[model samples]
Target: MTLEAIFGMASLLAIFSWIALFIFYPSKWIYQTLFSGVLIVLGIMYLFYLFTGIGSLADFNFDSLEQVRTVFSSDEALLAGWIHYLAFDLFVGMWISKDSWEKNISRWVLLPCLLFTFMMGPIGLMLYFIVRAIKTKKLNQSPFH
Candidate 1:
């Protein structure tokens, strides 16, 4: 397969995995099996691209943001960056699902967090923290405590 095709396929797979997780709320199978499997594949692709495809970590000049942009100029390097986002975002989504379930927060609340996590990594995570804080505070204030 071409590099572009591989990138597209991997991206789609990660996206579908996120939707599956949301649709099947609290599903251990989705989080543990499907998501985990996709992450492992993405991780291997990341390493492969890093070592044999475009460039190496040595190419990145930590001293300057401009140098960092220069290093990711290659198609392979860009894909690697994208794959990095996919892996981490999916991992975060899984964590959000598991944590929300454990906290007894409804799936309705988690849906947006999962979607945001997929679309814009840190924003989704930040939203989840807000949700958790509110839920936790309410629990603490219950007169039945």
Candidate 2:
């Protein structure tokens, strides 16, 4: 498949996973499907691209922004990087959803956090932290706590 098609598929999969979380909150099947079905698939793709496209890590070091940019100069490397972001962000979103459910945080309040997490990973997580702190009335060491 073309890289563009792969990107589109991954994006849609993540979106459907998020929607499933809303529809099936706290379901083991949903978590399993996301982790095994979505994340693992994405991980395999990431490895394939990283090994086949990026190749020899000795040639690249992420010690600086320029180095990072150099590594992502290849389209394959860029796609791998983008997939990395998509997978991790979706994982983080899943964590947030599960955690919020455990904490009894309303889904209405979580919508924005999830949306922000989808568009901008850290920003959505930060928003979740704020929401969590406000909802729980205490800032804990771990997000899960």
Candidate 3:
């Protein structure tokens, strides 16, 4: 296959793996392992692309982000990327929301989770953990403890 097609396939696979983890195994060790493995595979594929000089995956110069943005702005790539992003991030948000509910966390905290998924992908997961930690600390500090 052409390099661009290979890269696109690899990207799609990585995204699907992430979605599976989020939908089926969120917060579990198996999920973590699977997600990490997917990332490693993606990294290796990217390295292969870089070494082969077939096409640029990411360029480190000042215009790198703009370059990526431009590529993603195309109709086909944008549609595909948006599909991948929304499917995975929505699952992530749902997982976080479920975790919060399990911990008896207030629903208000979920707003940020939704925002994070829509805007920053995994950053929302990190924010969820941070909020969870804060809530846990408060619980521990309570007189009932």
Candidate 4:
């Protein structure tokens, strides 16, 4: 498949997953399906493209911005990079949903966080943290733990 086609499919799937979360908040099946299904599929695509593209990259390295730019210059590598963002951002969004549910945070409040996350990953996460701190009153709680 062409990179463009793959990109479109991935984007659509991500959007569908996000919508599912919004509609089916706190549903176990939704979480399982997204985590075990969509995430795994994206992970496989990420690995396939990363491996396939890295071998052909003459200057593949993460030592500097220029090296990273060179690595992503190719279509395959660029697609893989984009997929990486999609997968991780989706994962973060899912985490936000789950955590909000646990903290009794309202879905109405989560909408912006999820939307920002889908559009720009970290900003949404930061927004979530702020909301979480206010709602749960646990400012020091680490998201990782």
Candidate 3 residue lDDT tens string, 1-145: 7646765676576556545544453346645555566545555554454434423445322467876676555444544454456546655665675577667777667666656765798888778877877877652332122
Q: Candidate 2: lDDT of 54?
A: 68
Better of 1 and 2 by lDDT: 2
Give the Cα-based TM-score of candidate 2 against the true structure. Answer: 0.93
lDDT of 4 by residue, 19-132 (tens): 999888788999999989999999999988887877764567999998898788778889899999999999999999999998889999999999999999999999999999
**Global lDDT scores for all candidate models:** 0.82, 0.86, 0.58, 0.91
Q: How does model 1 score by TM-score?
A: 0.87
Candidate 2 lDDT by residue in tens digits, 63-86: 999988888888888888988998
Alpha-carbon error at 94 in model 3, in Å? 0.6
Over 35-127, each residue of candidate 1 has an lDDT whose tens digit, in order, gives 568889999988776555455567766578888787677777778888889999998888888888888999999999988999999999989
Model 4 — TM-score against the truth?
0.93
Candidate 4: Cα lDDT at 54: 76
Rank candidates, lDDT, best first: 4, 2, 1, 3
Mark the 10 consecutive residues where model 4 has the least summed lDDT: 51-60
Return the lDDT, model 3, position 63: 63
Q: Pairs clashing in candidate 2?
A: none
